[model samples]
Target: MNEPLIEKTSGWRGTRELWIQAAYGALLETGIDAVKVMPLAERMGLSRTSFYGHFSDRKDLLDALIQLWQSKNTGNLIRRTEAYAETITEAILNVFDLWLLPDLFDSRLEFAVRNWAHSDARLAAMLEEADIIRVEALQSMFERFGYDTVHASVRANTVYQTQIGYISMKKDGPSDPLAPRLERMRTYAEIFAGQPVTDAEAARFFARHPVNET
Candidate 1:
């Protein structure tokens, strides 16, 4: 008896989403070396022919994953920071907290990406552009808080770098839990903005700690 191939209803968008999700999952579980087209195709329960219909090669899949990441996380960060004009500082802190908290993505995924970036030019460029967008978003928030462009830019870079450093350090060795650090960063940001920190404000600081620790 011949079984029919069940057509996927997800169309191109669904197939692309599955590809990106699978790539991210594979990278997180086994690093970049494990993300070959054959393995990915197997994982997706699709034939090489079907996979080829979506991506030209492994590099193409990686490129698509990078675009998806930027579109979802980096793009949303920019939009949320801009849209929350009134509470710019709090909004910015919220964005940072999302990344810093546990269980969102294994911190190891970030570590792996950083190392992969060293050898892969395209990934490196994407990382650089993402950082620039983050800094720019922070600068805009600072300006809304009444800081001049120069000061705002500097502060933005400082905060942005501090986060990278914090994540890198956590990846390297022992450190405080992400929740406490996030709260501390929020308090510092409030003081940096020359505003009094309210308990309500501090409460938003530790809100997003994912319980499923990776």
Candidate 2:
């Protein structure tokens, strides 16, 4: 039947996407140590050469995957931040929330990437650049909220450090504890900014706009 044929075609497309998704998932679930080229090919039900058609080699694949993640996360952050750029406190909290989203930690890709960075200078440089981008984004939001340059930079770093600490704790301890910690973070931000958190505040902080043209 036509329906059966259509289903089969859709299945192939699904399979390819699944393979790509699995590659990232594997990296997150288990570090690069688990990423054997032959095994991944077999898992995808394809020959090793087929993978080469998609990527030149393992390193190539890794680079592509990192770029994909960076693009996705950066876009999401930019869109969300632009949507809500009103007050300093709201903007800071929005940044924190995006960084601490539950799905962000559900994978081991960050850990795997950190390990990869040790030997791969290129990867290390990319990670550093990503950090700078993130910090700058936060700083810009702070400036929109009326903070001076020095204070904005300092507060952004503080918030960033706190999020990193939370991630470290989630890895070392019970991740289920993150929600309460996030709440505490909000409380801390409120105290520091001397204002109550509000939905309008969050909305203004998350409002989207174009990146400034140089």
Candidate 3:
């Protein structure tokens, strides 16, 4: 019979990243309530004592989760949106690419964090801060493309809100395949930018930043 793989821990018996990853998995699979130390330790085939070695308490673990969401989702989006873009339309598309690609930003984690935000006031505040950062990144992108402050702000909110709505809404059945969905979102990009994105430009963008499935 094959033996179950054992998870090796470093000096302190386990690393902080191990606990954080297990907690993240629980948060995404079940919910925030499932992220308790005992449950996570049990899942890892370890005792609760080792959890305290990494996190101070349950609240500390929760805070770490929030911080992870802020850095992974918000920080990454800001970097991608603020990168090179010859036009506002391409900039909008760049931001959209983050949402479409799970490797860039994990949508499951995003939905989980949003759900957690509803039950915790402190986390809700962090969620709001992340939203502001994303909007400001979009606005800055528009400004760089020569849009005035007023127009940039409006366009930023428009693009950001549409994505928020998509995440918040309930869906049934299988989602549209990637190619068609990207095509539809390309139309949204044009509308949000108040400009047209030619087929050649869109193709170039996709070719340069091909979506990785593995």
- Of the candidates shown, which would achieve the greatest lDDT relative to the real structure? 3
- Give the Å shift of residue 45 in candidate 3: 0.4
TM-score of 2: 0.73
lDDT of each: 0.67, 0.60, 0.79
**Ten-residue segment with the worst summed lDDT in candidate 3?**
170-179
The TM-score obtained by model 1 is: 0.73
Task: Give candidate 3 regions above 4 Å deviation.
Answer: 1-12, 170-176, 208-214
lDDT of 1 by residue, 86-174 (tens): 46567666655546543333355556677678889878997888889878987888888788999889888877686678567764222
Work out candidate 3's RMSD over C-alphas: 3.5
Q: Write the per-residue lDDT of candidate 2 for residues 1-214, one digit (tens) a residue.
A: 1122112332243343454675776677676665666767655555566666666677776777777667766556565556554566766566555654534332245556766678779878987887788677777777777889998788777765665565545452234444455556567678656577786654443342212335
lDDT of 3 by residue, 1-214 (tens): 3221246555445778888888898898899999987778778766678887888888998888888888878888999888787777777777877776666777778889999989989888888988998899888888898899999999999988877777777321025356666667778888898789988769976775565477
Which candidate has the top score in TM-score? 3
Q: Estimate the TM-score of every prediction.
A: 0.73, 0.73, 0.88
TM-score, model 3 to reference: 0.88
